[model samples]
Target chain A: MVVAVAEESRGADHARPWIDQAKSDYWQLIDTEHRLEDLYNLVNVPQAIWIDEKGTIVRPPETAGSTDHFRRMDLKTRTLLPKDQEERLAARQAYVDAVRAWVTSGKHALSANAVRANLPRITPEMAESRARFRLGVWLRANGRAAEGDRQMAEASRLYPDSWSMWRQAADLDEVGKASSPAFWKRVQALGDKPYYPPPKF
Target chain B: MTKILTPTAEHDVAARDGLWMSPADAERVTGWTLKPEGMCRAEACVPLPASAVGTNEVDLAAFWARLGGPVIASDERDVWALGAPADERNATLEGLAAPDFTLPDVNGVPRSLSQLRGKKVFLATWASW
Candidate 1:
């Protein structure tokens, strides 16, 4: 099954279009508050976590954006975004091919130990940041907007490398905010670097 | 400022900031009231350090720790999480049984992860930005 966690504070309302267009045959979840982000330590978009039938996490969370979306990005779309289209498309296509091999292989794919080795390590700093992020979400949901914003800012400060965390809470009701600007600048700074670590095939 | 009065102390505090508050509000939040001696809840009372209390605000970091709760704040010292002692974050990673959560579906019905326990789940998080 598929759980489409819409990383929007506004809940499912913010993620309706993508879901409607997909016409997916699997379960689609709307993670309006980003519980999965905090739960699974999502640092960016298009990350997926695979759970086996016995409730075992054979594959941990990793960048899993669709290769088709990038493959079909026409000239108009290419200029609209800041990306090295050729390089990115190659990496994404390679990733798509690898995941297909793993998923289609199923029980014969890899041993539990091999998949476990691919999981990302949660450092002390990231752990604390995750806690603070979760708290920020909880506080915002519990009628503490100002406090929640402060916590969200802390989460960003503690883990500045995560675009997902920063952009998720960016775009304030007030225009010209710091969050959006910071996120954009970082993306520009990471011109050729791999924003996401290599996923486990 | 929240006005709170308990059997032993009475004061006001900015309850939303998690910074300083009256002894009563502190007790309201953590169930531990401030008294002439220290913080107390129900029958048990613990003596608070004289340095812990300030002219107006109490040291929440020290106080939260004394209650045996794990206190985590953002790098700015503005936001804090003070509920679970260890956060049990490692448990989620170690066990891998997708953490339980509830969110509104397309039709606005609240759906939980527990409902899909018996099945293999492919969870993916997306964004507009």
Candidate 2:
């Protein structure tokens, strides 16, 4: 089964014929808008759900195509230096390699025990943090900029070491829609942390 | 003993808190009815606040708030979130079955999900946003 994640803003006008071609080629095409709800089931982009012929999901959500961009040696070798950049780069590389291994092996490739061994168990607090981050996204989409920032801040607080959370906060701050110097400063502070630098700017 | 109240899909209450939905809206959007006294729509049962459930009305605020939804208010023309509230649900999307909708396509042609059932339906949605 081939699942195509399309941007919600552009429906199937651009994707219909290609999907049709895939169908003619004997592929079962399931197209969906890359929605936050999908993220709830699967995190990261280019994710795929391998459903068996009976329609049962054989594989739970996992990141599909592409390697992590931050892991390249070129990025690590770049000139303008932050002191903790190397460590961050190494961690990113590890994450990328892990994802690559998972993709190549599918479920059998990586034993369930091994997968569980590497994964950080989702605690209630962590789950709540993820929910808050989603709420932030929903609020931003609904035009509640300030509320979104507040929710993002809560998420950052709950998961202070998460680069994704910090990066999201920084992105919202940089957008300047919720213009507050203090908020931007908080974003910068999150970047200054050794393990989790704020995403570039 | 506190009786656990369940909100079914049949209760047609306006979701004042922007979380619990009216039966009509839920059915229209999700192709499921809120019933079973616990937000039961089809096979799903979402437990709700007992005090809020009534024969004709649902306490939209209490119900949706429990589901991590904050009630939104609208001015004459625009609606906005009331405040920042933490979400309790998973950020991941639920793999619920998509309800069949029979709406007009862009050219004013009506289409239904039943018409496309046997074939692999590549459904996509668009908004002007």
Candidate 3:
């Protein structure tokens, strides 16, 4: 079974059209509070976690076949050049093949110890940042925009790695700010660091 | 009244300076009720430290901090958020058990991760942005 979740603050208001377009028979959830982020330590989107029949996590959250090749795209054209697009597709296909192997033969599933070691570590700052993010979201929805923005900024400072938090806060301020030049600047700032670390089996 | 935020609910409760709230308010904000022994929810009980329990109120921030959860507040102290305990939040890392969550689908029907326990699940998350 496949369960897809749209982690949007506006919930169905923002995701309904995409959900409708998918036409998926599987469960499609709308998360307004980012429950998965708080629970699974997810930092970005297009991530997947594999669970087995006993509810054990066979795989911790990882990039679900997505790559950072978009960083090389032409922003003005908003398109990835053919070569980069092909490489991205190949990576996605490889991830899908691995998933198929796991489902069919449980060949790639990680042992419990391996899963434990691979789980993302929740640092003190990260935990506090998540709390501030939640508080900021609530404050913004409850008529405290300036205060909310402050809390969100503090959250971003505390956990610089959480592009999800920063982007969502940007989206709240301006509808297109998330994909704006600022996003590119942040990606460029990564320098040698990875935006989407490769998934480990 | 200060607005208290929890994972599943929010409440406006009376507080006297900082985050010290009446036991009743604490119980309302968090499902755990204050009793003679300690704070309790369902069958679990956690003994509160002396610093966390005041004359007739509880220092909610101290209580949650004792449980290794982050406690955040607004500048004016009008709003506060009590996060999940670090132990509970990171339990999946140690036990390999996927944490269960219930969320509303696009059609507004509530669905739970546990409902798919009998099968292999490819739990994928994406965003509209």
Off by over 4 Å in 2: A1-77, A80-108, A116-120, A141-143, A175-201, B1-14, B17-21, B26-32, B41-49, B60-129
lDDT of 3 by residue, A29-121 (tens): 988888788889888888899999999999989999999899899888889999999999999999999999988999789888888888888
User: What tens digits encode model 2's per-residue C-alpha lDDT throughout B17-66?
Assistant: 34344556444433434565566556766687667666644554454555
Q: Candidate order by DockQ, highest to lowest? A: 3, 1, 2
* C-alpha TM-score for every candidate: 0.64, 0.44, 0.93
Q: Which ten residues in a row have the lowest lDDT in candidate 2 chain A?
A: A192-201
Q: After superposition, how far is residue A8 of candidate 3 from its true place, in Å?
A: 0.8
DockQ-better candidate, 1 vs 3: 3
Q: In angstroms, how far off is A159's CA in candidate 3?
A: 0.9
Worst 10 residues of 1 chain A by lDDT: A171-180
Task: lDDT winner between 2 and 3, please give it.
Answer: 3
Fnat for the candidates in order: 0.57, 0.01, 0.79
- Which pairs of residues collide in candidate 3? none
- Per-residue lDDT of A1-201 in model 1, one digit per residue for the tens? 667777776556556787799888766666655566666667888888777666677777788754323322343544423465666677778865765655566632446677557655555566556556666765666577777777777777877777677776664323334235454466557766666666645
Chain B, TM-score, each prediction?
0.48, 0.39, 0.80
Runs with alpha carbons beyond 4 Å of true place in candidate 3: B35-37, B40-51
